[model samples]
Target: MTLIAERVRELTGARQPFVHATVVRAQAPTSAMPGDDAVILADGSIEGFVGGVCAETSVRAAALDTLRDGNTMLLRVLPDGAASFPDAPGAQVVVNPCLSGGAIEIFLRPMLPRPLIGVAGATTPIGAAVVTLAGFLDLEITEPMAYAGASAVVVAGLGRDDEQVIRAALDAGVPLISLVASRTRGAAVLDSLGLTAEERARVRPHAGIDIGARTHQEIALSVLAEIVRELRASSPEPVAAAPTRTAIDPICGMTVVIGEGTPHAVVDGVEHWFCCAGCRDRFVAAS
Candidate 1:
């Protein structure tokens, strides 16, 4: 038997998925029978039991071919039977025709990439946005002791002790890291850490949109809206474009983006815009 679990973890860290070939069923005469195991890495490398030179040779070659693209397959090798490089979901591994005589069955599974994110805060908005962004992306959200795949990480306490956390994140090669703070505070935190200007600039801070947020939940909404905005900026997936300007929904405190030329009336030094009559009614009633 092979240390399959460790290898799987390693392959996953490398963002490479491989095929899990197991000798589920076997027939007599062959030295290698059912219950044998082999890890077919994305690179087409095999670790574990080798059934036969002929079978191993062909499977290794086919596995590499599979790595170029993500395709799960199951192969059956017979004492003389051949191997087929089929697709996942229904593919089979047949490596039985080895000089050994027994037939071998191997299963192949493919792995794919995930979106990785490093968040600065996890309290409210940042946490929600990360969970949402991971809707399909590889998300790694990390906190003091929490680690979510390559989601978003919230730098709630961005200070000296936090240096390693940030540095480690960079070392881990996460795709994105967001800092939740005002520009001045963000600068101060970075400066205290003696980070290079370039490093400071690399952080996407300021949390999210500035829509008169006064509560933790509201702050989170603003940040999430900002993240969604950034995501929509380039995503091929369809999403409603946020209005360039948004007014706080006084009743619920939700930032309601108003389309251009929408009706608005100013009062108390702050402008209020509404997306619908109901919202407008609530805003007016709240006033």
Candidate 2:
């Protein structure tokens, strides 16, 4: 596999969010060619090259935006005063004064991890049903040992180790904790756990939407539906994303993402960011 492909695989395995940028169109004088691709990481670092620094600046900014909204975007980077292509709705256009004399178009696609869930008793009928249904819905399954990164945890062991899994889920701060038991048994088990009121409230005792489900399959379906509802009601982002800092390059007039990898300089105790070393050098020279 190519480096970018391997990197994508690694990121996916690690559950890291990133943007895949592919050069779709290139004009004369542009260094990047069609089919060239790069991976823009969460920290605004580019693993591969799609264009020169000016074009990269635009791509990075747009890539971060796509990561935030979980949307795909077509980015058009053209030199100042260059006539643009036929306007495409939802496409972002950026003019880079530092571009030598060409334009490049890149497609940015965000790759986010699937929501993971933990199941206590995978061998039981209801637990197995939940796993199968969750797999069909593309939700990843985890064990109690991996609950730290789980979005939800369901104890379908029917009192067998249910308390242990539920307690672990609560301790992990999982968003959703479910116990597959009747109201009376569930309440008793919860009360015996010696948990705080808030912690007990976090668990949904008769776990499942009130659909009068009798069979294991029906109960599993209801439980999955409840989990989906809870997930949708919470924040769309899997985690709270750190805010991005950006600045305009004084010489090139291009917006640059401010990060450890970005070129920057300090003048008169004021820090100024630049798209590339050349822009930073020019700014320092003029100052």
Candidate 3:
């Protein structure tokens, strides 16, 4: 159990998603006892045993489901030939095919990572934004090159190399890129970039929830709020026709549009989009 806990920490720190399964209850004839735990990797492999081979299959299926839904589930596995039992509230039932007339109940929980937000620029607004965002999200405070794995990137340089930073994020195919500048200044910078009209539309100006933010902290909060909205939206529209705005799905490594109805998973709180259900299933199975 101690080793399982340590592995969980290590995987989460590395921003990987995994399922933890624990046997909470067991009936006579079962090979597993209460308190037995195991870590299920993404490839449908188990690091520990909750029961014999039959019970393992049920547990792995439940773990994959929990990972996909980002929810905790109580799984009750009844032995072959046994009468099905009533499911508790929010618990799922699985009928094992093994000959052993034993029942096992396992609880599955998935640990996902928070989204990583990259704040570029050394300006006061950028610094304040990074500090303020620390309480709400995982932050990566660095230049555009450091945004390689960031879920979203925000430029708050207040005109200092804003174009360069924005270009870098765009070039890297970041899903969300916002500029913390006034409308006029943002438009001027965009114009200077010589981007086509369609490309310019992909860049959000005055990036924030419009609450009339004037101070640095307030602006930062507003920006963070907008980011939350983006993360939680059920169907977000894809950015306008920007050639550079293409995201690669981590699950299958396929390039996908960062748009509405795109299948994605939040691993260790970081968002990882998928190209299709098969890929998503594979990812969860392997995780």
Candidate 4:
């Protein structure tokens, strides 16, 4: 496999979110050629070369934007005063004053991990139905032991260890906690757990939206629909912790995402972040 492909596999195995940036068009005098690629990790580190430091800076910022919106973007990086063609939706134009003279267009695609769901009673009909139906919807069905990492946890045992699983999900801070039970039984079970009012509110006792579901399969459909609703509301998993933040480069006036790998220099007890080391050096020299 290609090195970029291998890195993608490794990240996928680790369930780490990242953006794959590929240069689809490179104008004259550009350092990056068409097909040059790079992997932008969640931490804003670039794994490969798409362009020089200036172009990479713009790509890094745009890549992070794509990660936030869960959209693939075609980023057009042009030199100062260079007019770009009109862009369609999911396309952006960035003017980099530090560019040598040519324009570069890179495709930034965010690779997000599948939303994981934990079912408490995998062998039971309701739980098994969740697993089976999740397969069709491309959701990851994880074991109860891995509930801590799940986007949502469903206690489908119908009273079997319902309190234990519910408590575990609550403690884990899973985004969606559901119990597959009738209204009365679910309420009694939740009350018996002695959870706080807010904690009890977090658990969806009926588990699914009221869809007049009667059979096991129908009920499972409703429950999965509810899970899908929550997923849509949150816009997928692994997007929970990363917040988009950027600062303008003092010298070049380029916007740079504030990350561990970004170049920065402190002057007069005030720290300033830069898009590239060259800009940082210029700022330091002027300071």
Using lDDT as the measure, the top candidate is: 2
Give the higher-lDDT candidate: 1 or 4. 4
Q: What is the C-alpha lDDT of each candidate?
A: 0.53, 0.88, 0.70, 0.85
lDDT of 3: 0.70
In the order shown, the candidates' Cα RMSDs to the true structure are 25.9, 1.8, 12.7, 3.1
Task: Give one digit per residue, the lDDT tens place, for model 2 in 87-126.
Answer: 7788788889888787888999999888999999888999
Q: Over the stretch 1-287, how does candidate 3's per-residue lDDT look in tens digits?
A: 48878888888787676788999888888889999889876555678779875566567666766666677889998865686545578778766544268788888987666566677764575556555665556553544467765667778777777888888877776667778888898788888898866667667877889998787778888877787787778443221112223356564344544434456777777777665555667777777
TM-score of 4: 0.84
Candidate 2 residue-wise lDDT at 113: 87
Winner by TM-score: 2
> Per-residue lDDT for 1-287 in model 1, tens only?
24876776786677555666665554564456666777765444568774654455446544554555456566665444433323346554443222345555565555544444455444455455545554544443444533434534445443434556565555554434556677887666566666556666545656667899876656656665665566556453121222234455453343343444343556687777643455556566667
- Write out the backbone clash pairs for model 4: none
TM-score of each: 0.43, 0.93, 0.73, 0.84
* Model 1, CA-based lDDT: 0.53
Candidate 1 vs candidate 3: which has greater lDDT? 3
lDDT tens digits, residue span 1-287, model 4: 88998999999878888999999988878899999898998777899989998898898878877777788899999999876655657678889998988888899999988888989988899888888999998888876757777888888887788888888888887878889998899889978988888888778988998899988888889999998998788664345537768889988788878888788988999999997888899899988
RMSD of candidate 1 to true structure, Å:
25.9
List residue ranges in candidate 4 displaced over 4 A.
83-90, 234-252, 258-287
TM-score of 1: 0.43
